[model samples]
Target: MPTLPISLVIITYNEAGHIARCLDSVPFAAEKIVVDSGSTDDTVAIATRHGAKVVQQPWLGFGPQRNFATTQATHDWILVLDADEYLSPELAAELERRLPTVMAGAAAVGILRRSTYYMGAPMRWYRPMVGERMARLYHRGRARWADVRVHESLRWEGSTVDFAAPFHHLHNPTLVHKQLKVLRYAELKCRDWLEKGKPVRMWQLPLVFIAAFLKDYLLRLAFLDGWRGFAVAHTAATYAAYKRLRYFEMRRNPDSVALAQAELIRYRLER
Candidate 1:
């Protein structure tokens, strides 16, 4: 059986530790494109060694950067994967099987379930709500990423279908790493809020945190995973609270935007 031709597009910055594994997992791809922001690491070299065409571009936020990468692909059928994510063998085979149907216009997008690992183990109860299922496989001409920084998603008018298996996401390898990830994401969220002129509801701050905790812990069944679950739930709640607090602080201070910009600069430099 002949395999379907597709381009695998990935965006990276300082992902030296995981890029090779990510590229290796997608041996079926006809072409691999990696759009990288400036990295003072071995990310670009490793990706090139793994047969990915590496393009150097400065950070343009999540959605915009992904859109730029898609344009550089040789094929219309594109599969976007993060540096820390890779397809399971089952999922890879499923993609090879389904690509023909997708190219025939049966569906405009293919959704895949992602199972996230924390500290080298799968998180049984604390699955992130945003990435449960993602439309990572799509025809570039028919879809585009929404213009959001933290949790951008694909926008398409056609039908979609789910893949048979899940992709593996090695996200949080350590507690400190997890915290830093949350902080960075929260900072981006706060910036988005400020950009949209969204006002912070100072009065509902406590309630917002409480609701986040309950939803993740009780409603999402994070408790079933034991101490790790609790930690995930607590961290999620704290992220929500921190974003709100950051937004409020920005709203109150006259020099907040400058401060935020400085912090983002520092973040990019450190990474």
Candidate 2:
């Protein structure tokens, strides 16, 4: 059978520094659709300069943005990518050689997204690597990102493969951004937990934090990456702690009327 020509899709938002590097890897994709969520930076220009079609849209969260990117594509088989991620050379060659044969039965392709993290100075003692095998390439209608706002998985409906090649994900270049991103994720996660009626015991904070720390930093072998590992371990624990703390804040009902006004003001400022 002839090979399945594919389209590579990417979602971007203020990713000026990384978009060009991302689009650089798959120049031969039959089509490349970049769904942007109002990037004030040159992300759109960079993608367009690379011969990709850039579609600007509102911030609709992660899963929906990705799904919208799929809708704008011109082909059934899609190679979904994050603007901060890029295909490694080994994966690219393997995908070009074998992807077509496996395209039909496979609803998605699993690729390990190797993350790189840094501190104020690229922490030699605590670098956390991306430990995820995400479903990227798939049939047009076979899968979509789940509705959950944080750590959402692909809603897939068929067989998958443990693709050996890794996808490079340059997560956070500095400690400030890293901490900020995790906190944002923590807020979303707390909302998810609250929606599900999850308990908000103060004790649950340390327990969940420690457990998540162990799973990612130790069990997932995130420590193998050295400094990046320690940072990840620490961040995972911090995020859990923050989420549980927020949950308690709402549960216990902080009765300071003045603070309530301040909270609303802060919320408006952040948004």
Candidate 3:
């Protein structure tokens, strides 16, 4: 049989609940590489059991870890994935069939990401105004992950292809877990603003919140998802509120700057 030429790479940190399924969804890739950030759980075992090569490393932020995983892959065409994300069957098939021809010189491919959680519930309102679509497949030596601490993505060195088949991101379900994600993401942005000594305005917070809500709820058609859309919009509002409130707290307690810096340090350490 002709060999597959693309590799699927993922960076993980204690993603035991969803790693197996994510790896299982893209068996056609030439290789599956898992770079685990010292997962205490059976995440490493799980990846290996599913025929993926597992490498261990300390957390080093999102992009760096992904780049680290790329080192272990032998193939020229690479597909980067998250432990909680998977390939939709239709899209996977399409990629499998088109990649080699596309990979001949294609710089990168942007695949749609249709995310769900809480039992496949689509949280339309909470999703990003511009949802994330990772540049997964790209020729080796031509693509690399950026160095951003969060939401880092691949830097494709050539032209791009946009696929209609959406990747699936199964986010954590519990309300508390979801809120924590909001808090983590918000806290990061708040700290980013504080370090830069960005000025805060009384009206700006509410405006930003409203803008995010309108973009996601009204513009993104969150209404189509029913309750999920409402939940997402509400969560987005909560995140905006958290960012502003945290910003206020930092300004009021100048000493908290040290605390925020420490949290960022810990986050980078755990990445």
Candidate 4:
């Protein structure tokens, strides 16, 4: 059997902490490409040392950045991965066995289940069915990421295959990091909503939050995971509510928006 060639593509900024582990996990890759967006840390150096071709570009939005990285790959088959994610041993073996078949078949995209971990432990019962699966492997010419700022997905017209082994995602390393991530995502969501002229009704704020909590905690069976499940559900609900509330506040009070913008600028400068 002939080996299937694949290019591993990743986009990063200040991801020196996980770059080594991520690169180490995919030793079978024919080429490793890291498209960095001006990392202040040793991300570039780490990737280069790991035998990856590193390219620097300014921060494009998430979808654009991923698409840009795909363009740099020399192989036809590309596996897009986040800096905080890595292939499990089982997954790597599965890929090695399955890629040849997939390449010969008509499938243009490959989907895999991703098991997310919070603070070093897996969130086993959180939205098990819906949030776990993603399309990360695809032929570069057959698929492209949507042009959205947050929650972007791939657009593919061909058939897709689902791999059995799951990818390990180190979602949040700590509670503090989780909180910051939720807030930053909320901010970007609010900005995107405002740009798209999406109207937020102040009256729907509480209702939306309640619905989000119920959907995740009850319907999604987050409670089955214990305290971490509850925390995940609550944080997701809070993120949804906060983004809407922030958008409303910004639209209603320009003075508050100005102050918030100034504070953000000051914080960035200080950092």
Candidate 5:
């Protein structure tokens, strides 16, 4: 089958372990661009070997990094993917068959993502409140990622369509790995809030944790996935709590904020 006139844009830092699978999954892309921050590993070499045009860039937060990658694409239609994410066979086929027709009237294509946990089976429900629909494929002119430090998303106007398939997300497969990521993400979110001059909400910690847990476990139907679902909800609640706790800590002990900032810089370099 001939490839589509689309460019695959990915941002990476020390992603050698997963880059190959990510690059191989998108065989339909006419071109692939990898905007990599300094990687101590062989991430750049592996991407280059896989026929991707690799651009060296410094870490610029999650949202900014993705936006910068979109600008490097040769094609107007872009597919933004994470190093741990790839298209499932059904989704790949659906994308090739439907994208041309969808693009005629839609600004972006929202694909459902099926994510796994701790090397276990993929969860049937993961954060349903937020919706599993991810706007990954889009015209760069109409969509761009929000300039946030952590949880970033593409914002766009006009009509949008959904692909009736699920993209595979092989997320952190171990508890240790997941915990480290949670810490990093929570810190980043706290930093963003601090930068925005948001006040510390110490009193809301318990309420936030309870609300987040119930939202994921009950409202999101995470219970359907069994223990894995419970773990997911529990972890998510912990994250919500931690972000607030970090803010509270930073406000009480200003020196801790500097330590976290240094840790974040180290994480950016090594992550």
Candidate 6:
């Protein structure tokens, strides 16, 4: 196999169901590294068996963990993928064909991420809800992950080009999984806001939820997908509301911070 001068870096917890498929999809990676924050499931063993160098580290916030993973890579060019996301065959082939030019000049490459919901339908129009174009493939020297708890992204000053194809996101396999994910993300975002001393705008909670729903369903054209669109848009709006609610709770009752931290740790260890 002709490999690109790129290293694939993935961060995982209890992703036994998705890790192997993600690893197998990127044969063009010159190196593959999985940084696991103590998965009680078979994530570590499975990743190691699939030709990834597994590194066991305690959980840091998302951005820091990803930046740490980049340090473990053998190549300066980095390809970041979540445990549940994998490159499509067309996307992978496109990367192999264009990456050399990308590495020579571009700061990073952004690819469209098409997600599959719990009901198993691949969404055609959820871009506004999730910012479908993501800067996943980049050079470590030119771009790095932002230091945020939730919604961490790549930060770079140079120009980024978009790829023609999209990668697949096997998002939230079940209802329970989706619920837990929202809660976990809400808590993390709450903590980030608290640390920054940002006050919760009480009036914006309901307004934000409404805006998120309309953005997803109407502006993004998710309504074209019928019930599936409604469900995903509702979920996005719920997440927006829950995140603010979590912030208000933690800010008003400082004592709850300890409980929230414990819950987060438990979720990471057990999930």
Top candidate when judged by TM-score against the true structure: 1
Ranking by lDDT: 1, 4, 6, 5, 3, 2
lDDT of 5 by residue, 90-205 (tens): 88898889877766765564555554533555665556522367788888888889998789988987677777767777778787888988988888788788778898768898
TM-score of 4: 0.92
Check candidate 3 and list the clashing pairs: 59-271, 60-271, 76-140, 126-232
Clashes of 5: 0
Over 1-271, each residue of candidate 1 has an lDDT whose tens digit, in order, gives 3435899999998999999999988888989999999888999999999999999988888888899999899899999999999999988888888777778875778889999887567878665632488889998878999878778989997888888688989976789888877777777777789889997798988998999999999998888878877887899889888888888988888497677678767766323
Candidate 5 Cα errors over 4 Å, as ranges: 115-118, 125-131, 264-271
As for candidate 5, its clashing pairs are none
Clashes of each: 0, 9, 4, 0, 0, 0
Give the whole-model CA lDDT for all candidates, comma-separated.
0.85, 0.71, 0.74, 0.84, 0.82, 0.83
RMSD of 3: 3.4
lDDT of 4 by residue, 86-200 (tens): 9999999999888888977778899998988875687767776334889999998889998776677999989999998888888878888777767666666676787788976
What are the root-mean-square deviations of the candidates from the true structure over C-alphas?
2.0, 4.3, 3.4, 2.5, 2.2, 2.0
lDDT of 6 by residue, 138-217 (tens): 88888888888768988886877788777788777776788887888788888889889997798998899999999888
> TM-score of model 3 relative to the true fold?
0.83
Clashing pairs in 2: 115-130, 125-227, 126-227, 126-228, 126-231, 127-227, 127-228, 127-229, 128-228
Candidate 4 residue pairs in backbone clash: none
Candidate 1, which ten residues in sequence have the lowest lDDT sum?
A: 262-271
Residue-by-residue lDDT tens digits, candidate 2, 70-129: 789888888887787888888777787777677656445544445443443222323334
Better of 3 and 6 by lDDT: 6
Off by over 4 Å in 6: 110-118, 128-131, 267-271
lDDT of model 2, residue 119: 45
Clashes of 6: 0
**Residue 92 error for model 4, in Å?**
0.4
TM-score of each: 0.94, 0.82, 0.83, 0.92, 0.92, 0.93
* Ten-residue region with minimum lDDT total, candidate 4: 262-271
